[model samples]
Target chain A: MLERLSDKWVTLVLTGLASGPRRYSDLSRRIAGVSQKMLTQTLRGLERDGLVRRTVTPSVPVRVDYELTPLGESLMPLVAAIKGWAEANIQTVEAARKTYDAA
Target chain B: MLERLSDKWVTLVLTGLASGPRRYSDLSRRIAGVSQKMLTQTLRGLERDGLVRRTVTPSVPVRVDYELTPLGESLMPLVAAIKGWAEANIQTVEAARKTYDAA
Candidate 1:
């Protein structure tokens, strides 16, 4: 499970779901640039790990919604902290990159 | 940089560095289960990205030390928060796991 969440797409998917339950297509739309295959694979992995719940309802064309489980919801604060940390230190990291490249 | 930090070993290495500067061998030891190849690779990646500093002292047996750069140290609080969040909600996750398994 720990190993599973370490992927870039997984983190992005989780961040997208942090907003609310999203259908498969909506998730693919919300996270720009992820391939359909990758999005589906990541979502299944999250579901298998018990981090996400997938609900399928009979509709005109089968409506499906994916939402954070308790386990997944519990991870939100940590994700937010990490995102906040990244935003806070991006300046220093960029400056360091410039310095490193100059060196 | 964000893409790079999303790896499991990167997170583990950053957590290990959160303690203090450590030699390559010490980091391998401190992390308590990372493969030598993975550790070296992850450290090299961090160094390349300027998130970590590598210091070498010339001697009969040359000593090399690695530590968090300012940007790396900046991630400590976030790492701590994530780890702390995981620790705090472990029970909830576990319970969720049981419920999930039973279902």
Candidate 2:
């Protein structure tokens, strides 16, 4: 569970869906650098975990959208906090790594 | 950064040190399933990230203790929340997975 939550792609995919439902292409574009296989796997994991819902719309071309389940939504504040901490402290962490490596 | 923060070993190690400094042996014992190599790696990663401090005491066996830095302490509430959420919702998640798999 921790592994799944901490996964980089999982973080990205959850964040992408936080605002609203998104098509796979939208997520693939928003999360830059995520491979198709990884995105699919992450979505599947999230769906299985009951944190995400996958909706399929039948049209000329089938449309699949992913959105957060209530459980997933409840987790957003925590996820956002983690993301905020990472963004704010990444520089400090990088400097620490450099200093540690030099020692 | 999210990956590091979300890591299962990282969570366990940080939680183990949440109260105060602990010896490697103590942490190894506290975090039941963690291997020695993984514990060492997690501690090193935390140290490098500036979230943990390692003190070496010159003793017969060179006593080593690990404690959270201010930054690490700051992260505890978040980690605690995640831990709480996981414990509370794990059964629900398991049920969801079982249902998903059966369908």
Candidate 3:
């Protein structure tokens, strides 16, 4: 389970879904650099883990949307926290890397 | 940075060092499934990221210890929360997977 949660794609997909439900294309576009195959797999993994819900609507194009389950919603804060930490500390980490590389 | 933080080995290593400083062997023993190469790589990555500190004591056979740096310590609560969520929700996730697979 930790392995699943620790996946980079999982983190990105969850973040994409955090605001609300999104169609497959929306996610693919929002999470730039994610391949279609990787995105699909990540969504499937999250769905299987009960952290995401896939909803299909009967429409002309047959719309498909992905959103967080309550279980998934519960995990958002932690995910957000992790993201926040990354954004806040990225410079520090980069500096450390440069120093380590030089040493 | 998010990619690094989302690594399974990173999660395990951080958890292993949550208590205090530990020798390389201690981390190896504690994180049961990690290989020597992976542990060494993970520790090196953590050190490079400025999340861990490695100290060597030149005594009988020389002693080395790895501990969380202040930056790493700052990230611990979030990591702990993630681990806690995994522990608390494993059953539900397992059930979800079972249901998903059956369908």
Best by TM-score: 2
lDDT scores of the candidates, listed in order: 0.80, 0.88, 0.90
Each prediction's TM-score against the native? Answer: 0.72, 0.85, 0.82
Candidate 2 Cα errors over 4 Å, as ranges: B33-35, B59-61
How many angstroms is residue A74 displaced in model 3 relative to the true structure, after the best TM-score fit?
Answer: 0.9
User: Any residue pairs clashing in model 3, and if so which?
Assistant: none
Q: Which one wins by DockQ: 1 or 3?
A: 3
lDDT per residue for candidate 1 within B24-103, as digits (tens), equals 88888878779999899888778877789999999769999999988788777766665676677667666766776677
Best by lDDT: 3
RMSD of each: 3.8, 2.3, 2.7
Which ranking of candidates, highest lDDT first?
3, 2, 1
The DockQ leader among the candidates is 2
Q: List the residue pairs that clash in candidate 2.
A: none
Candidate 2 versus the native: TM-score? 0.85
Residue A14, candidate 1: Cα error in Å is 2.3
Predicted complex 3: CAPRI docking category: medium
